[model samples]
Target: MATLLHIDSSVFPHGASASRPVTDAFRRTWEEQHPQGTVIYRDLATDPVPHLTADAHLAGFSDPATHTPEQAAAFAARVALIEELEGADAVLIGAPMYNYSIPSTLKAWLDNVILAGRTFMAEDSKIKGTPVTIVASRGGSYAPGTPREDYEYVQTYLRAVLADTLGLDVDFIVPELTMAPQNPAMTELVPLYEASRERALEDATTKAKELTERLAA
Candidate 1:
């Protein structure tokens, strides 16, 4: 049976977070498409992983047999994280932009999982073809030519780390102006927000099903 690594990093809970519902939509459709598929769910907001540490960094490169108790423990956690990635048929990430970048929780998860030799090689990434869908939610519009385009660092950083470094081809389903309806100053953007939100939902459903077929094929 297929397995999906489902990760939510939004500090905002469901219903309040745009990324949350889009990821949920994908998960719901994915489950329907693969009734027997396994979901390795991780809520980074609720249970955040510790940021990368010196001990963990050293442990990542040390030989397992020579590791001290501390190194062994850290290495073991890293291994487990990598194992989850290795066992997944696809990955779904709820990556909401915070101050023009991904949440610290998601970044921490990446730091923990992006190990050397295990998930990648010196020249190429091991999981080069794995399907990764990122639901990228932003409070402001950042499409090309937009005033904040240069400030849109979430997708660019994620792509570099996931696709360039880890060899995963990532696709993004973006929902822009997520805070428009709530922000009085954003009243003019409500229409754009609504349109983008609707498109994001539809895309999530389509992409989730498409990923299943891609993985199985």
Candidate 2:
């Protein structure tokens, strides 16, 4: 059976997090298609991984046999996280924008998982061609021509690391204006917010089924 790595980094609880529900939708759809498939879940909000420390950064490059106990422990964490990513055929990420960027917890996860010569190398990437679906939720509008279009960093940053570095096959599902309902300043865009949410779910459902079929094939 296919294996999926489902990761959620939203600080908010499930009911309050916009990205969580969208990722949940994709997960539900995927599970329906492959009831026996494996799902590896990591909730970064509650169980955040430590950011890459100086030792951890150096440990990634040093030979395993030469690692001291301190360096070994740091490198061990990266190995475990990398193993999870390497074992999965597909990945689902919930990346809610915090101040026009991804959560620090998510960034920490990335730093650990994207190791040189392990997740990637000079000529080829170890996780190359692995499909990754990112549900990017933003509070305010940041689409083309929007006032803060250039400020959108979540997708840009992920693409650079996941696709450019790790060589993952990446696609994004953006659910914009998530704060419209709660922000008085964005009250006028509530309808658009609803529409964006609906579209996000629809896109997730379709892409999920497609990915499942691909895996089965």
Candidate with top TM-score is 2
126-149 in candidate 1: lDDT tens per residue? 466788999999999999999889
Candidate 1 similarity to native, TM-score: 0.96
How accurate locally is residue 117 in candidate 2, as Cα lDDT from 0 to 100?
Answer: 82
At residue 105, candidate 1 shows an lDDT of 91
Model 1 regions lying over 4 Å from their true place? 122-126
TM-score of every model versus the real structure: 0.96, 0.97
Query: What ranges in model 2 sit over 4 Å off?
Result: 122-125
Clashing pairs in 2: none
lDDT of 2 at 119: 82
Q: Residue 135 of model 1: what lDDT? A: 97
lDDT of 1 at 127: 67
